[model samples]
Target: MNQFKNGDKAYVIYRNPHTQNVATIQEAIITESPENNEELSLFLMDTHYPLQDDYAIYTTYEEAVKMYNYYFEDNEQSEM
Candidate 1:
């Protein structure tokens, strides 16, 4: 398990919950999870989201973009 302290930079591929089709790579900051003192959260888009395994959070923008391209671009082409 990766542990991040406050102010650590994180890169995430964010998909709007209300608009599923819209997605982008966004930078976030690591913060203490408000709901759980023992866990970490990603502060992005004015919201605090608990960091989880399924989020696929990356340490670098390039890593996040690579995953975004694979999921959004390459996946679409492969299905065609």
Candidate 2:
């Protein structure tokens, strides 16, 4: 069974095709079950579509955002 619920929050890091960098790492809501029973998909609440189903699923909203911000910051630091 999937760990995510309909309103659960999650984070997905996707690479930008053009820049080959972090495209988007934002908070998402799980609106539906994942394609596979063992995996959880990222669902954009606004778009009403699954962004991706192959990443980490944070236990809380803060946790997910914190991880995203940290990664983003680390990438920025590396760019400097």
Clash counts for all predictions: 0, 1
Error of 2 at 65 (Å): 3.4
Best candidate per lDDT, number?
1
Global lDDT scores for all candidate models = 0.86, 0.61
In the range 5-42, model 1's lDDT, one tens digit per residue, is 88899998888889997898999999988898788888
Worst 10 residues of 1 by lDDT: 1-10
Model 1 off-target regions past 4 Å? Answer: 1-3
Model 1 error, position 68 (Å): 0.8
Candidate 2 deviation (Cα RMSD): 4.5
lDDT of 2 by residue, 1-80 (tens): 16667667766554565896555666677765456644444565455554334555565657766776777877798999
In model 2, where do residues sit more than 4 Å from their true spots?
33-41, 45-53, 75-80
